[model samples]
Target: MSTMGNSTNIFWQESPIGKLERQKLLNQKGCVVWITGLSGSGKSTLACSLSRELYTRGKLSYILDGDNLRHGLNKDLGFKADDRTENIRRVGEVAKLFADTGLICIASLISPYRKDRDACRAMLPDANFIEARLLEDGLHEHVRQEIQKAFTSLHVLERLKIFSPYLDLISLHSRSYIQPGFTGIDDPYEPPLNCEIEIQQKDGDCPTPGAMAGEVVSYLEEKGWDVYQQASGSNM
Candidate 1:
């Protein structure tokens, strides 16, 4: 209703040097590697491993681990749903800024909701968003299977009755609700569909972590991200 409001316009300015300039100087393409999974999953492990591997290849990269960030950047936040959402939003903004500056940003967090991850993806370009899944495997799977088998060995009704007290305790609390297809509590994790890559828990033909790192590095190289060329271009 105010004529002055309609006359207001924002101004756009061009930077002397842009993202491509920084990317050229950094000798690598900037992107985001978002790792998601439950607690005790291998998100942090993979992020650290990838950072080391990239360093060995002379590619610049930074890893943002959950505990490391929460200790400072997000120390005041709690685990409430809204707090969780805001935490992820802030992380996404920071990661996008980092990527814009030509740094490969690897965020290892239990970003549970699909909505949160999607929000991150929207902030980054399609070519720059890489979703890495950390699956449960190795010793953890073996332990879980052994426990389940042991529990199954007992008579069904007897087993239920034995754990009835614990079930009663759980039933007494009703702080959260599970949506269909949801698999976890404390946070709800939605697996990525059509992801760029999926890391399996069972080590296959590869012998060690180095082999896995090599595979990832090779994949990134094949994607036309020539860090050396970019860096050289920046210098020229």
Candidate 2:
């Protein structure tokens, strides 16, 4: 048998630790990485890669993928607009918890509805949001070719920003899961006005996950996520 130490558990007590203390334990500053894209888009793929980089740097982080949530926290939800709203609402709440604990929360969801995403954004701090765009139109051979054609029409930079049409196709295919955009089904997503970082798509035949991860790390660092030293000035 084991004997208890000369310690007592109290039902309640005054606050003892602050978020800064937890942040110290976690090392790196915490934020939320909200990755939204069409099905077949690389939302989860990018999220996984991002998490790997965070782990490599000894940063505390976690990924909240949509499918996994449906199986657990949001198991009772369905595909109706209201249900989708509730789903995002719940996820946002959980993400907030992780962020509060000073852990980088990476959420990969279709999250096609802007209103839901906006609600989540409102719940988090201003500087804690990082948005990345992943073009899913590359899934189909014909569509990929179409994207290639569209790519040529504009400069290489614009080509990487081809998610507009890809999102349209996704909305069409997954109408049930998607709540029609408030402006229009084809409503465009307003780029993050003050996002700490934006991972734009890169050109070329090969994937550039490493470069993208480097950008995210750079943004985290720029935001004052220094695991080794305490924040002297302001929070990111």
Candidate 3:
């Protein structure tokens, strides 16, 4: 049991068509790869790349990007601590639905707070949802990409320096009144201690987001949830 929903006096309506039935039809077991980190952490890149890789391997996957959601479903929400928690909660519900229906739902968001991220984790059963943390070192390619796409020809080093103090403060505290919901500013972003798969793009590893995506796919395969396994008539 991952979590208990908020509603009371309401019962869950079990679907006549279960997850196994859907998975067998789709040739894949559903799961949510919740990618959590700060902005410019390469979550968007990872999500898209992973989705494409899975698709190429004859698997069904979808990316639910944070910015894309804000333009529609979460548009009404502001950047307050409570609003941020609610945002993740809503995304978790959607991801749960996607996972139940045999789809790999990749949720990329700057889910700053540890509690919020944990709540999302609780929404799915063990192994169904994985927390993928993208650390600063893994974002070297992200820095390069963002710089190239910058409208003002901003320097990457300068930007990192600007954001460093805030992150340092966040490392010391869980919440701050000044930055409100901004992680590493006024809000804290608790790094995952034991994530299922930690893709490190460090000094000696594959440096591209695509490579990290492949690593995630490989990790999933090792966990006995390979999407391709279904096609071979093997049970996960």
Candidate 4:
């Protein structure tokens, strides 16, 4: 692995303005929200909804839809498995660039292959990769647990104090996000355990997206990002 990487090594030019400076100027941290689900599962909707929520709160964000990119950046790629993998690989790089600019990049892609998705996550620094699952048709409790167990292993790897990496992850799901052979179902899904947050769509006794948005906003605020917060009457 080391030899292969060395063989492919190329010069990495440093940007005059680094990620930290960019984030500081933008008053926000940049990261990628990789939204994956079956077609018509509302991944795009969730991305748009989350983007709007972020926008109102004074944060900048962008969306890279899988279908839309085929018209341009990924035009050369086809639907063959290999082509699809390459397509997603390019998208990952683009998403990382957007995140580096202090803009939250919402990448709504089918991204079916677990290995491919994991590879995309690996492209960025730890805690920068967030995988959001849209559960429209629903999931069995046991399966959810299994997926969570799989995800838990990946997240808790930053225990060492020295050179340890922090992770920021969350999962969201609901109805209208299901399909035959869809991820988390016929196909395998790796859900996150110990996620920072989770939003359930139309849960029997759950909160609405608006409520979840508030929760997310609160999280961002707590993290010191410049998010739009409602004016409070507190005089501290």
Per-residue CA lDDT of candidate 2, range 1-236, in tens? 22444546534433677667888666566688888765555667778888888776667689999889999999999766788789989998898878888898998887767778889989987877666555443343455455445434443434567557876565454444334342112334343444455554456342577766666767677767653243343432
User: Per-residue lDDT for 32-79 in model 3, tens only?
Assistant: 999987666678889989998888777889888887999988999988
Q: Which residue pairs overlap in candidate 4's backbone?
A: 57-228, 127-167, 135-174, 136-174, 136-175, 136-176, 136-177
Task: Give me the candidate number with maximum TM-score.
Answer: 3
Model 1 RMSD in Å is: 6.9
| TM-score per candidate, chains pooled | 0.71, 0.66, 0.75, 0.65
Locate the minimum summed-lDDT window of 10 residues in model 1: 174-183
Clashing pairs in 3: none
Per-candidate local distance difference test = 0.70, 0.68, 0.77, 0.68
Global CA lDDT computed for model 2: 0.68
C-alpha lDDT (0 to 100) for residue 50 of candidate 2: 82
lDDT of 1 by residue, 1-236 (tens): 23443464645567999999897777678998888876656677778788887876677888888768788888888677777788888888889988988888988888887888889889998879887766655654565455444434333534566556755454333113222222353235678776676766454322256655555666677787763333334352
Determine the C-alpha RMSD for candidate 4 after optimal superposition of all C-alphas: 15.3
lDDT, candidate 1, at 127:
73
lDDT of 4 by residue, 1-236 (tens): 13445475565677889988887676678988787765555677677777889877667889999989999999998766688789999999999999888898989898877777888889999878777765543444555555556454433543432232233232222222332244444455545443444556565543455665565566656655546643233310
